[model samples]
Target: MSESDFTVRSVPMLLSRNKSQEWRDIVLLRSGMLMRFLKTHNLLINVEPFDENGNVKDDLVIKKSHLTDDGLELFKKVIPGWSQYLDKGGDVNNINRLIKGLEKIRNQ
Candidate 1:
């Protein structure tokens, strides 16, 4: 109803923080309730913790970057300006804007 209602202290967060059944139970219970409130009466804001990437996307995921070194070398012939940013620690996620909708295609 108000901003104060969405504060962390107002939430029923599970105390457990591990890869176990207890954690899974907490997520399942909370996520379901959150969805029902949204779909039924449009009652509450969907502030659930699970993210667009399932709250499990690791940027350092072994193959998260579809751009391989060899691919970049060949791509350099096209957009050479990307190297200036990429070489300076620019994130590939940031470059996805240049990709229109091709970003998801590459990730798969």
Candidate 2:
């Protein structure tokens, strides 16, 4: 798909009325067929913090990062069309677009 096809819009992420809400740009990475996989699996992107000595911290956090070799392979197998987008550290612009699209879809 072309870049124009991946345009994203901004959306609000709010939790409570008394608290301040965070806003971020959103994009849609996958739709239609891929949605089923997402619904079935509780996949997590694990990130362990490390100190200057390269030792992992005690607290592990769920965070986003570039996919590992195994992760890339699995992702490609699941969504071939989107595999390219995950390469080269992924397209930040397109990711933003995807998030927005997802937000729109969720609201609908």
Candidate 3:
């Protein structure tokens, strides 16, 4: 599959099933799924196993356009409120506050 086709297939799988509280895990899972899909379609380049330290042995050289398109589509579906929560970066205190605020609104 082409990058676009891989992206289309992967995003829905990610958006439909994730319950991770960590934003980093969410992104990693999305990226890993996309990479796996690309590999399955024989579209990825220089596939390598992770090292003992759990780092990729080689760099993944994908175009920014493909990455941007895939990430934007995935986030749009999986985390509609992600930007509102992550706009300030690693603001878990604010995430807590925001959740409480939404709870208050919901209880009204």
Candidate 4:
């Protein structure tokens, strides 16, 4: 049920639900909480487990875009090669990705 759970799908709800700012706040909080819980259980989806080439493995759980800054920070602590994957001099693509990821999390 993790894939279809309300906490996983935020923009559109299959069930009738409140749309107030207060409700949205609660939803965001719950979503964060859910991610934390999943992380501890090793059930969260995302790019972890680098391949032999030191890149992300072919697997996913929670998406990076859906994560809050705190969530990403927490998740990063668990990954082995997160730093190696980032920080190329002229190639600021990963930097931009980090910024966008953080912004999207904060905006939510």
Q: Every model's Cα RMSD, please? A: 18.8, 15.7, 13.7, 15.2
Let me know the TM-score candidate 1 reaches against the reference structure. Answer: 0.25
- Per-residue C-alpha lDDT of model 4 across residues 74-104, encoded as one tens digit per residue: 4564321322443222331234444444445
Tens digits of per-residue lDDT, candidate 2, 23-103, equal: 111112222123223323323234323345543332322222323333333343434434356544565334443344344
lDDT-best of 1 and 2: 1
Per-residue accuracy of model 1 over 1-108 as CA lDDT, tens digit each: 532311221122332345677655544544343333222432223233334745421221111132334333223332344435544666533543235223433455
Better of 1 and 4 by TM-score: 4
TM-score of each: 0.25, 0.21, 0.30, 0.30
Model with the higher TM-score, candidate 1 or 3: 3
Instruction: Give per-residue CA lDDT, model 3, range 53-82, as digits (tens).
Output: 653323333432443433333333433453
Candidate scoring better on lDDT of 1 and 3 = 3
Model 3 lDDT-worst window of ten = 55-64
Which regions of candidate 1 deviate over 4 angstroms? 1-12, 15-19, 45-108
What is the lDDT for 24 in model 2?
15
> How does model 2 fare in lDDT?
0.32
